[model samples]
Every structure is written in structure tokens, then in C-alpha cells.
Target: MIRVAVVGAGLVASHYAAGLQRLKRAEIEPYGVPLAKFKVIKDYVEEEVVSAYDVDANKVGKPLSEVVKRQLEGVVPVPPDVPDFEVREGVLASSGAGLDKMFPVRGRDQKLPLKEAVEEIAKEFKSDNVNVVLNLISTEPAEPFGDEGKLAKALERGEVSAGQAYAFAAYLAAKDSGKPVAFINLIPTPLANDPAFVKLYEDANSLVLGDDGATGATPLTADLLEHLAERNRKVRYIVQFNIGGNTDFLALTIPERNLMKEKTKSSVVEDILGYDAPHYIKPTGYVEAIGDRKFVAMDIEWITFNGLVDELIVNMRINDSPALAGLAVDLVRLAAALLEKGVKGTFYDVNAFFMKNPGPKEARNKARIKAYYDMISALRELGVIVE
Candidate 1:
């Protein structure tokens, strides 16, 4: 029985929880282990919904059933049985770094300080036996100063109110626990990218991979356009307009953090075209506050030898969290697979599919992602990977 723990319990986390349910009927090997050993074990097919935790007051301490119940009360409803786990209290930290101003400010009474909140989360994971932490917390503008290491050290040395310290502390606990922690940052944070933080996760035998969720709009547009423009045609201009009302777009609207979003949106097209892609690609604005729904627009112009011009425009809409749900399901399964095989450190193949912006962005092969996923799916079919 492999114990799987969900850390966020947010919109996307629920998707992960739901995906786990969908994956329940499918038999997949845990991580790196071959499927041959488990092929004959019919009883190892159980997919247990162990735990779900979040910092929201409405969710903290609630039974998983009740949490699912309340989440349905929102405009966007979730299936009653989607999350079949216990929803516990997660670390609730005070919104520092001026991020709270972006949304309806959290009431002072609802927020918890950094140390207290992190300790609460550590205690929950330790008590619950959670194997993976999928950080689906609300996005914040990129930290203006890339000083997470210095700040983490400072917090460890003394007391720090900022959540950065608590986050680092959580990483530290996961690393030293021998539990093979895997940090999947759906938001753009410096935890994995920072040299100091990377060293910490590495030394602790935990895998830290993130930077972006790569959901659908930005990366999909970049990929399709890049392929189109690379067909021996003279390319001229490209404009990608993405609009959404999720926490992700709201967070990026903060001027200070636009750079991270820009870098992510740019890299997708740039990687494919094999040249600098001059384009406008980013989250334009928020609309309706409709949970996790998003709308994307893509426009391109290419010229012909006869001085003729061709223009292309595309519109794409998707449920952001559910799209990511499948990916997250595969990710947790991969993490559990690695743990079962006693494999540690970075798992590049798993990262490639799950993260939009990975640590080694330059080493990715998009063509091979589907083949790798096929192998994973095949292993599951053979009853080799179980969570």
C-alpha cells in the first residue's frame, strides 16, 4: 500500500485528487521499478485516498468529504466523489511581500504567521505520511529580489515573519525525513531554481523541479506557432493574447513579477523556432473570477516571395485546473514510482511532462514526451505502478 498525500487541496490539487481516482482503475508501476514483479499481484491495485490539506479556513480541519462538499458550493462545482481523502489543515501564513493587496485581502483573523503556519504543515505531513507536496498555492508576483537563500539562512538562524523562511523550512523537513520528497512548484518560485535551495533539496534526497505549470494556453500556442513558422516560410510577426481570471493571472498582473511570465511565454516559441521569436505572449487580464477557466488568442503573420502576407489567428479555451489535473496525477505516480525503486534526486522525464519551465529547460525533447508517456501508460496497464 503506497501512501499518497496531497499538500495543496486547492483547485488544481483537487484535480490531482480526481486524476488519482481516474488512475485508480489503471495499474501503473510506482516509479522506476519494472512492471514484471507486480504483474501477478492482483491485490495491489487499490488506490487509496490518503490525505488532502489546505490553509483555507473553510477547508482546514474539515473531513475530506466535507471539503469536497464546500468546494461544490462555489460557482464551479466539483464531483462529490472527486476527492476521496481527508482534508486537513495546511500551513496558513500571513500574506507578506505585499501579495495580499492583489486580491480581496485575507482577514487579519484568518491569517497565521510564518513559523506557526509552517510548523503546522510539517506536523501534518509527518503525521499523515504524505509522500509528495504539489504546491498549488495561489501565485504571487516573482520575488523582486532573488535572495531566497540569504533569507532562508536568516530565518533558520532567527525568526522571520515572511513565508519564504517557512517554505524553506518545509523543504528542509521533507529533505531530511528520508521520505523522498518531491517539490512540484506549479507557481513560479525560486525554491528549486535557486542554487542554495537546489543544494538543499539535492542533499536531502528530495527532487525539486518547477518554475511553471505549462498548462495549455501559453505553451500550446508557442508550440503550434513555432511548428507552423518553421515550415520554410518567411515569418514576420507573432502576437499571443491570453486572458483568464484565475489566481495565476491575477498574481502576474503585479508589474514586478511580469518578467517571469514573459520568460516562460517567450521560451516556448523560441525553443521551437530556433531563433529569437518576436512576439507578445502573456496573461492580458482577469475576467469574471471564474475559478480556473481561461481563454487564449493567438495571431501570426508570414510573408511570401511575391510580397504577399498571410495572417493566422487562433482562439483556445480550457479548464485550467483539470487540464493540469492529468499531468499532476501522472507526476505523483512518478514520484511514488521513484520512491518504490529507491531512486532519488531529479527525475528528468517526469519533470519534462509536468513542468512548463524545468530546471534544465535546454535539455528537453518535446517529441519524446509522448513516447515516454506511452511507456508509462504501458507500465500502468501491466499493473507495475501502484500508488
Candidate 2:
């Protein structure tokens, strides 16, 4: 079994927990999960969320079903089989400010020493035999610790971000248990990209697989850029923005928090187009009424043959949280299978397809179409996928 632990019990986590249970019960088809049609080393039924953590005062100590019901009551049916484990208090570290604006914040770090809190969380992972730990917290402002010594110093000073703290806890869990763990980061913090964290996971014989999930507008924008690039279209300029009502969007209203999304979202332009296209791509606003379905608008102008200027405009309303939740379903199983195959450290092929900024610090973004085939090919060669 691929036992999993969730780091945040927010909207996305609610969707993931509820949707996963429904998938297991065969109550709904796995329509949104990308690799559901393919045969993978780990079956979807083998995946289970054994534990979850959160820093919100309202969420901590509450059952996941209760949290899912509170967030998804009328929106979607809360799965009756969703895990009943209490959501433990997670680390706050440098992430408290933005989260504090949304709800009452209380992290284990606030009550115990930061390291002790991490150890406590790690103990749970070891006890639960968690093979995959998903970081689905709201975006927070953070910089990479390029060196292991620097990371250790930051942890000692309690200056690490919440993602970093939880990553360390997973590392500790792997080290103590002598079992491999996959820390799948679905947030913007730099675990997969940071050499320090990558090396740390390598030492623990574990894996770290992200920087940011490529869920909504960013992946679509990437493929459009690729289409333009392949057709030899000289892109004049591109503009893309999203506005939503989720707590994540509200968190982005903070300048620093928003900048984190900008870095991950904007990287696709330069990486895929082979030149930095003049573009504005990021979350622009938060409207409470818009809820989890976000509004996306994109405009691109390009120079065609005969000095002609052509323009393309696209608009969409995307279910933001459930989209990532679907991706999480695949990632959890993939992470466990990769670990079982003795693939430690970070894997770029998987990250390239799933993450906005695929990691190991040097990887670049690729169009989702090409990335999808390339990742499938790689996984096949590794015996992680069949047929």
C-alpha cells in the first residue's frame, strides 16, 4: 500500500481526500486523473491518505471528513470513506503571516521548538508508514537554501519556511525508518529545485518531486507558446492572468506571496519560447464570489508572414483546486512506485510534466503535450509503466 500524508487540509486537500475515496469505492470514474487509463506499477486502489496536517486553528484536531464537509458541503459530496484521522497541527515558521490573514493560525512551532515540532510530525509519518507526503499549503514567500549548511543554519535559527520544515520532517522519517519516502511538493516553495533539499533527500534515500504544480492557465499557456514556436511564429507579446476566490487567491493579494506564483508561472515563457517573450502571466486578483472556479484570460500577438500581425484571445473558467487534486492522485502513486524501483533523489522526467518549474535546479519548462509523451516514455523505460 502507498500510505500518504497531506500537509494542508484546505480546498485542494478536501477535493483530493474526497475524490480519492470515491475513486477507491468506484463510485465515480477517474476522469480528471491524468494517468488513470495507463497501467502503472502502483494501482490507484493501493493509494491511501493515512494522515494530514494543518496550521489553522479551525482545522487542527478536526477529522478530515469534517474539514471536507465544511469546505465542500454543497459543492461536492464528502466521501463517507474519507480517512477519519485528526488533522495534526503543522509547522508555521515563516508562513504564518499570510495564513493568519485568512484564519486563526496556530502551528506546532508556536507551541514547541521548531525542530521538536518537525520531529513530532516525523514520528507520525514513521508510525503510519507514510510513503508519500503531499505539500498542498497556500503559497508563501521563500528563497532556496542553496547549500546544505545554509539549510541547517536556517532550520536552527527557525528561519525556514513551513514547506522546508515539513520536508525536513519527511527526511527524518525516512532516515529513522530506513524506508524511502517521496515528498511531493504541490506548492511554490523550492524543495525540488533547492540543491540543499535534493541532497538531503538523496541522503535519506527518498525523493522530492516539485516546486509548483502546473494546474490551470500556466500549462495551457505553455502549449500555446510551443505551438507558436513550432510554427516559426515570432511572438510579439503575451498576456495571461487569473482571478479567483479561493484562500490561495486571497493569499496572493499579499505582494510577497503573489511574487512566488509569478516566479513559477512566468518561467514558462522564457523556457519554452527560447526567449523571454514580453508577457504578464500571474494571478491578478481575488474575488470572493468566484470561489474555486477561477477566471482566466489570455491574449497573444505574433508576427506572421508578410509582416502581418495576428492575435489570439482565449478565456476560461477553471476549477482550480480539483484540477490539482486530480494531478495529486497520479503523483502519489508515481512517487511510491519510483521509490519502490529504487529511484531516489528527484526525478526530472516526472517533474517536467507535472510541475510548472521542474526541478534539480537546472531543468526548464516544456510544453505539456511534449512533456506528457516524454514522461510516459521515460516511465516505460524505467518499468514504472506498462503498455
Candidate 3:
């Protein structure tokens, strides 16, 4: 069984936890509940509530048991046999990763030193046999700008970040554990892109990949549009506008960070269309207190030589985290399989199908999914298993 440690225990983190639990047969342990279910306090009442943590006075020092009760608020409770995990304090300075207005405000607690945090994570891995770390934190638009080496050294030296020490601190800690670590980023952050970070993982003989997990309508829309374009269909322009009250949406409200997300999302579509398809992809708005739902509106324009133009408009709303959280569960198992088989950085197929921003763009639609299956099959033929 691959013991995977989830970095953040927020709303999305909860979904990731649930998704993993759903895959229990596949060996994914719950880090907590899914963010959506967390809101449905009544639903978790009888469900198994694993580990949960946040920096909030209301919840800061609360025990795992209390946290579970508080989370239940008005929801139904499950059987008493359902176990609960501890709610640690100062795991983060702020849920600023995205927990601003959507979820309850986190309390201000003394932050953990980066060194101590790393040591805690490393110790957990060493003792628990955690093989990979999945970052289901908020959508941190700001990516690492080539400073993972500094971050890695800080972990070794016990350096901690209270007010935004480099974001890759968690990645470095996982690497330092000396256990083969495979990191899957579901948010649009750049930890996996920096050369230094990549090298650190490579040097450690571990694996790291993913800048974003392409969940929900984004991937569904992108792949579908690509299908039309590949068929020699004329794609004049594409515009995708999205809005949600989820933490991911709440996090991108920062103007600077929003721009980064816009550019990254736009580029994914741009790259898929090859320079031929003009397009705009942006997170249009943030609706607070709606819990965890994402609404997407997409418009596609195509022209035919007959001098006529055709347009396609589509709307989709997804339960933000669950749509992609399911994939994250698969990724942990996939990562373990790769490590057990001695695969190196960026396993292409899993990254392509499961990530928003893969290392490279390949053919869209069935071809892309097919390619991924082939890659995993090849690896399996090599007899890789999670050690």
C-alpha cells in the first residue's frame, strides 16, 4: 500500500480524501473529507472522517473528534465506528492558498518552521511508508521561479516559511524523505516547472510532474474543441469564461494571480489549436457562499469556405473538486507504479490525461486518452508496482 500524504486539509483537500477513500481497494488512504462534503456537514456525520487541519481559532486547537463534530454542524452523523484524524495547527499561515471568503476564515496561529514542517512530513513518510505527496491545496497561481534548490536546502536545514517562504517547501520535504516521491499538482502552480525543482527530484531519483490538474469543463471542453479542429473543421475563435465560488475560484480573485491563471488556461487551448485557433480562456468571476460549484460557458466559432459561419456555445457546471479529485486518486496509484518500476520524471500518459498543463501537448480526444493507456500499459509490461 502506498501511504500518500496530502499537504492541505481544506475543502478541495477533503474531496481528494474522499476520492482516495473511494479507491481504497487501490490503496489510497483518506487525508480528510472532500471540500464539497465538508460543506454538507450533515453528510459526513456517519462517514469516516480521517485527518483534518487548519489554522483557525474556531478550529485551530480543536481535536480531530471535535473537528468532525463541527464539520457535521447540521448534517447526519455516521456510525461511531468511523474514525477521525487529528486536526493539527499552523500547517499554513493562511488558507490564502484560496480559503478566503468561501470557507470559514482560518485562525492566525504561530506558523510551523519550514524545517519542522519538512521533518514532520519526512517522519510520517518514513514511519508510514508514504510513497507520494499529492498537493490538492488551493489554486496558487504564482509558480516557483527557479528557487527549488534554496527550498530544498532550507528543508535540510529546518527553515520554515510563515509568510510565504517559497511555495515548493512541501515538495522539497517529500524529496528529502529519501522515499521516491511523485507530486501531482491539481492547481495551476509552477513547482514542477522550475529547473532546480526538477533537478532536485531527478537527483533524488524520485519523480515530479504536473503544473495543473485539468479537471471539470476545462479538460472536457479543451478535448472536445480539439476534436473539431483535428477533423479539419475550421475553428475561427474560442472563448471560455468560467465562474465559481469554490476555493480555486476564490483564490484566483487576486488580480495578479488571476492573470497567471488566465494566461495558463488560455495557453492550454491555444497550444491545442496550434496557432490556427484564435481564443480566449479566462476565469470570469467569483461567486461567494455558493459552496463548491463551477459554471463554465464556452463559445466556439468556425467558418466554412461556403462563406457561411457556424458557432457553438456550451455551458457546464461541475462540482469543482470531485470532477478532478477522482483523477488525483488514480495519479497516486499511478505514481507508485512508476516509482516501483524505476520510471523517472514526468510519466507522459498520466500527466497528459490527468493534468491541466502536461509537459507537452499531444493529439486531442480519443487519441490522447489512447496514448495514455498505451504508456501505462508499456510500464505495466515492465512489471512496476508500488513498493
Candidate 4:
């Protein structure tokens, strides 16, 4: 079985728990899950959320089932069979300032030293036999630790971001247990992109996939840019923005946190188009009344034949958290299967399609359509995708 652990108990985590249970019960079709149709080495039914962690005081001690009901109350039906494991206290480190603005914060590090808290969490992972750990926390301001020595120094000074702390915990879990674990970072911390963490995971025979989950306007904009690129269209400028009511969007109201997201979102232009286009792309605001469904607006102007200018304006309303939750479902299964195939470190084939910034610090974002086919081909060659 592919045992899983979630690092955040937010809306995305709630949707993942509820939707996964429903999918396992066959109460719902796997509509949003991208890889549901293909037969992978690991099946969806074999995946179980065995543990969860969060730094929010209100969520730390509550059962995941109750948390799901509270977050998704009228939005989605919470399966009665959702796991009842308590959401354990997670690490906070330097990332808690913005989170404190949203909710009362409490973390294991507050009660103990950062290293000890990481060790405590790692013990839980070992005890729970977790094969995949999902970092679904809020966007935190973090810089890549290019060297393992620098990462170790930062951990010593408790200067690492929460995502980095948890990733280290997962690494420790794998090292101590002699069983590989996969840490899929869905938030905007730089674990997968950081060479230090990638090398650390490799040493433990574990895997790290992420930087940021691309589940909305970012991917769509990428494909559109590719469409223009393939046609040799010269792009003048691009403007895209999202406004949402989710806690994540609220968290993005903090300039540093919002900047973290912008860095990931804006990378698509230069990476996919092969030239840095003038673009303004990022989450702009949080309107509580709008709830989790986010408003996305995009305006692109490109030079057409004979230097004629063409413009495309598109607007969409997307369910933010649930979109990432769908991708999480595929990621959890893929992570476990990849580990079984002895794939350690960050896998670019998987990240290019699912993550906004991909990984390894140098990996360029690809158009989702091209990324999808390329990833499928890579997986099939690895025997991870049998169908």
C-alpha cells in the first residue's frame, strides 16, 4: 500500500482527503485526476492518507475528518469514511509571520528546538510507514540552498522555511527506516529546485517533486504562449491575474508570500517562449465572498502577419484548491510508483507537467500539452505506466 502524509490541513488537503475517499468508494468518477485512466505501478485505491500535519492552532489537534467537514462544509460532500487521524503540529520556522496574520499559529518548533521538532515529525513518518509526504502548505518566502553545507547551517540557525524543515524530516525518515519516501512539494518553497535538498533526498534514496503545483491560469497561459511560439508569432506583452477567497489567496496578500507565487507564475513566459516577454502574471487579490472559486483574467497582445497586432482576452472562474487537490491525487500515486522504480531525487518529467517552476533550479517550464505527452512517454519507458 502507498501510505501518505499531508503537511498542511488546509482546503486543498480537505478536498484531497474527502475526494480521495469518495474515489476509493467509487462514489465519484475520477473526473479531475489526470492519470486516473492509465494503469500505473501504484493504483489509487492503494493510496491512504495515514498521517497529517499543520501549524494552525485550531487544526493541529483535530481529526482530519472534522477538519475536512469544517473547511469543505457546503462546498463539497465530505465522505463519512475520511481518515480520523489527528492533524499533528507541523514546523513553522521563519514562515509563520504571514500565517500568524491569518490564524493563531502553533508549531512543534515553538515548543522545542527546530531540529528536535523535525526529528519528532520524522519519527511519526517512520511509525506511520509513510511512503509519500505532500507539502500543501501556504506559499512561503524561501531562497534555494544550493549547497548541502549551507542548508545544514540554516537548519542549525532555524533559518530554514517550514517546507524545508518538513522536507528534511522526510529525508530523515527515509534514512532511518532504510525505506525511500517521496516528498511532493505543492507549495512555492524551493525544495525540489534546491540542489541541496535534491542531493539530500538522493542520499536517502528518496524523491522530491515540486516547487509549485500548476493547476489553473498558469498552465493555460503556458499552452497559449506555446501556441503563439509554434506559429512564430511575436508576443508583445501578456497580462494575467487571479483573485480568490481561499486561505491561500489570503496568505498571498502578504507581499513576500505573493512575490513567491509571482516568481513561479511568471517563469512560464521566459521558459516556454524562449524569450522574456513583458508579462504581469500573479494572484492579485483575495475576496472572501468569492470563496475558493478564483477569478482569472488574461489579456495577451502579439504581433501577427505583416506586424498586425492581435489580442486575446479570456476570463475564467476556477475552483482553486480542488484543482490542486486533483493534481495531488495523481502526484501521490506517481511519487510512490517512482520510488518503487528506484527513481530518487527530483524527476523533471513529472514536474514539467504538474509544477509551475518544475525543479533542479534549471528546468524550464513546458507547455502543458507537450509536457503531458513527454511525461507519459517517459513514464511508459520506465515501466511506471503500463497501459
**Residue range 1-387, candidate 2, lDDT tens digits:** 889999999999999999998888888999989999999989978988899999889999998889988999899888788888899888998878867778999888878889788888899899999999999988998999998899888888889999999999999999999999999999999999999999999999999999899999988999999999999899999999899999999999999999999999989998998999899998999999999999999999999999899999999999999999999999999999899889988999999999999998998999999999999999999999987
Per-prediction TM-score: 0.74, 0.99, 0.75, 0.99
lDDT of 4 by residue, 289-384 (tens): 999989999999999999999999999999989899999999999999899899999999999999999998888899999999999999999999
Instruction: After superposing candidate 4 on the true structure, give the runs of residues whose Cα lies further than 4 Å from its correct spot.
Output: none
Q: Better model by TM-score, 1 or 4?
A: 4
Q: Model 3, range 1-387, lDDT digits (tens) per residue?
A: 555555455555555554444444334434422222112112221223233335544655555445544443343232233235565544443225445454555532235554565455445545555566666555544535355557556545544332222234334455566667666665666555556566666666677767677766667666766677676567888888888886567667877668767655665565565554777788878887655677888898887567579888898777776666556655666666677677765565556666666642232322344445565565446654211
Q: Candidate 3 deviates by what RMSD?
A: 7.0
Model 4, position 28: C-alpha lDDT score: 92
Between candidates 1 and 3, the lDDT winner: 1
lDDT of each: 0.56, 0.92, 0.56, 0.93
Candidate 2: stretches off by over 4 Å: none
Residue 151 of candidate 2: its Cα lDDT? 88
Pairs of residues clashing in candidate 4: none
lDDT of 1: 0.56
lDDT tens digits by residue: candidate 1, 1-387:
545555555667665554455445443333322232433222223334577655555666667766654543554434446644556654434233445464323322245655545656666666666666666665544342235456555454434332344345446567556665666666665455455555666667766666566677655564565466556556676787777776566666776556667765566555556665578877777785645678878888877567788888888787877667556555555556665555445555555555665554334424223524654664465444553
Clashes of each: 9, 0, 18, 0
